[model samples]
Target: MEKVVRHRGWQWLVGVWCMLAGHMACAQARTELLHRAQENLTRVIVHDIFSPPVASRIYLYANAAAYETLVLGDSRYVSLHNQANMFPKIDQPAAASHINYELAALYAFLRTGGKLVFSEPMLKDSSEHILAGVGEVDEVIYQNSLRLGEMVSDSILAWSSRDNYAATRKKRRYAYSKEKGKWTPTPPGYIDAVEPYWSQIRPVALDSAAQFKPVPPPAFNTDAASDFMKEVKEVYDVTRKLSKEEILIASFWDCNPFYLNTQGHLNFATKKLSPGGHWMSIAGQATQRAGKSWIETSKVYLLTSIALFDGFISCWDEKYRSQMIRPETVINAYMDEKWRPLLQTPPFPEYTSGHSVISTAAALVLERELGEGFVFDDRTEMPYGLPMRRFASFTAAAEEAAISRLYGGIHYRSAIVNGQKQGRGIGNQVIQKIRLNAGIGK
Candidate 1:
């Protein structure tokens, strides 16, 4: 009888140990829950073929929603509302409430992102799968966490409604100008200019959309000896004479989500990440490489997304303002009518390259958060079929992204150089203005 009693006691201990171990494993995987949610958002953005500028807006709101949720009930983190404008005060968890903050973060992210994009079903399916896994473990915690998530998501969605996005949607299409310097549609799709009133949308960090506008692009000049013409000639010559490495560099960074391919009588679009999406991938890689905690990871994403958002606003404000002509239009009309750029020219005005401004802004934020001299191999394009590329540092990667525009035959040299300056300026602004609470994030 004593031996049987001892055997029963050992069995109970083993059962309890297994249960505790399982809970721990789920807890650890929750960090990855954030990454999975991020990946889902990235995929949806790509599939939906959002223009680069619009994609930046989507990233900003989603991650901002996530970070705000993360800060709730955790004194280690701080809400952006405390640092920047446009945020409403979010109520903390009730004193007796039981909530899993990370799950709440994912919920807010998916909910906000779904509201912004057209393909809600795609994102909704993924969200359900993630939540179902939590449900199996502990129905009570899952219910509580989701309730917290919904509350946080509701506040953010409400804030987003007032950002003038819908008002911009009702605005007229971009009207073209016959003047030589002004922008017009490109070949293939010739889609209307994307988000022309994006400047009018409320900024998350900037005082206004024009806060860090670049200097006006060089005046329209075609004389061979003119500075403006020289930059145009440089783009023409470099793209036509691109070496294998240069071609690779251009192709690697060709994050044009609007790229259209044509066959005999048939044209199809090849959807890919925008330049800002690629930077988001890099931010994720850096966090994983350094083994950052879930909270730390959310902070990195939130700041980087903010930089991308403001950079686009600053870049686009100049793009439409200068209304500079694209290289393809110039080279084909004057230099070679039969010539086609190595990459498709996006449908928008050219001046301050969007790639340069956003890349530099994102890199600067990452550099400050990840520290200088941080190294990582970018596999962001791998899913799009490009091999991974290594970078010695964040700024180095940003420089390459800026120059890729010239090699891709999309922007003039001045656009690339000045865009870098513009982006760096925006980055400095974001890094200075938006900071972690108590300086816990490093």
Candidate 2:
């Protein structure tokens, strides 16, 4: 009886040991997976920010979706650092950190299957952390570090790489650009002549522009704008209604980008590269040189699309919140109905320009990723089928195009300015919280 009892005890002990070992192995796997997901999310964020506008949008959305899935698993804490590290390389470290924290907390709540709420103090702490960590690095290097983190994470976790996704996306963008044909250029003399007139009215322009400044909820009235002001208004209105003053208190908080009808006469005449123009070809060449695979290259385009759409929504919300009258509304009331804007007005409010914000924010993010001094020849086509004009910097091109909306009489100058600021804010916020497993930030 004693021998039988000892045998039973030994078997039970062995079984317990095996179960413990299996549990440990599973825990390790979960940790590694979480870490890898966090890393990939970082990379995706960096890549989306640095890539072309279209490409960035696509990747941003996909990254967000993927992150959402990962956050639901055992490795969810990996995204905790995202808020601390998002836009860690930008000049506005404090703002970036704040955004990162806000997003991280939101993601945490989501992962916990809890309700979402924005936390201001946490975001501020995150900004401080990032600033302290990257105090010495140059802006470019700092930005690259964020990207490197992503690359490392993806590689270790076996996620898609930027090069591979970029290649396929580039092909599609290139095909679209080809179909759009060439854009006509604005003459040097015309630009020069316009500059003097623009200078003379600059003060009045700035003053008038102040009226369209981004207002928080309760102050902004979406009902005042036309029904056509759907997309642009949605972003502004939603943000104002949702975001608290604490959320808007950051130094770089005002740097959001806006959109407007730049497709008018000036845009056509400038012969600048349009968003839909030969982006695919440019991306393709870049991808091939890097030796990226198809899955990786395709992600570039996917992210870009996502960003663009998100920008549109965000900007629209802003407009709705402010409910400020559009240039068309004011101008038409005073001027002739025949005095139409150079570009067809988008079906949204004119307070904040969605395109201006998205494009500028995208440019800022891309410039950081691609390198500040790096210049690329832009042979891409423009809207209205004109020849492409080259630019030294993506931001410069986007800025010019954004301002052109004012000159073309499609948007109030103030609207474009505010839009750009807002767009940058949104982009930074979104970029910081991207984790491979966590997905898009709240």
Candidate 3:
């Protein structure tokens, strides 16, 4: 009887020890996973600044998965599967693979909730999903996994989500009409008062779709002008040459964020431009105190604040309507292959430079709001890890930069000239509309 009792006690002790070890391993895995996810998410956000919409959506979904993981502890897998159903349109094989990994991880975390050991299959699936998404080969995966493993082994490290980095408050005082129940727009003569300065500024233009003589389409291969094709080829070559997924990821990442409509206004306002770059610093300061908090940092507010979006949209609509070819395409084949641009050509039809129209319109709006004397420092930085450059007035910055593309071999001088003129017209129209709508100083 005594021997049997002792044996039973020993068995119970072994069982308890195994359970405790499993719990510790599970906790370590969760912490490590969270940290890995957060690092990727940060990179995604930074890269999104220049990216288009489709890629940005994928990153958004990844972020959402991480958030769910954090909230539900080990139940993130089930949560993601549920969420995947919400985005019914994202049924691509690649996306489905990612969903499966999340599901597996969630299951492992839940099954061993608080246990120390994670299922090997779950870890493998998670790692595979990440690798597949970025197109990294197995070797790169091993390196990332090793780094994560080292971090996991350390008990003190913890992971947290990145905070919202966008500006989200209004700085100006605004009132809505009580009787008519509509927000009052800014006054009309407000913009006309600023028009004289525009006449002093140089105009920018684009390739004439129809000439004064009405010539036929220039005889040339249009495919040579395709920026998309160039990008695809460049990406393929980079992947082959470097064999580093990080570089490829960085390239794609750089182009994704700008595509999204979210928080651009806040980003633009809060973003420090080059000194003497553009706009009145006083206007940036003045609007820092007006209206609803959320509206203040909105893209609409910033663009409208300077009254540039109106002219920008008008010019854009007309430019695209004409659909002119860029100089990069024309000059390359007709001119020389050795002729390279100083600045990369923006991907779009070139009629009027979008930057010129928008920048000039903003300058006009800023001059009106803050008067001609208001000056601010420019602090805009270059994309990627490039060095920062400074400027003087927004108009000076706009004009020089617009012209720089010509010097850079990307745009024709004509396009720059016509763009500037079209932008001015658009700015004047926007000012008139705002004044008429606002019932302000007419």
TM-score of each: 0.92, 0.39, 0.36
Query: Candidate 1 — number of clashing residue pairs?
Result: 0
lDDT tens digits, residue span 142-202, model 2: 4433443333233322222321333433332111111111111122121110011111111
Per-prediction count of colliding residue pairs?
Answer: 0, 93, 57
Q: lDDT per residue, candidate 3, 312-366, as tens digits?
A: 3344444434445555444444445454333344444455555555556666655
- lDDT, each prediction: 0.82, 0.36, 0.33
Between candidates 1 and 3, which one is better according to TM-score? 1
Using TM-score as the measure, which candidate wins? 1
Ranking by lDDT: 1, 2, 3
Q: What is the lDDT of residue 440 in candidate 3?
A: 48
| Best candidate according to lDDT | 1
Q: Give per-residue lDDT, candidate 3, residue 205.
A: 18
Ranking by TM-score: 1, 2, 3
lDDT (Cα, tens digit) per residue for candidate 1, span 333-407: 878888888889988888989999999999999999899899999999888788899999999999999899999
Q: Which residue ranges in model 3 land beyond 4 Å of their true spot?
A: 1-300, 303-308, 382-392, 436-441
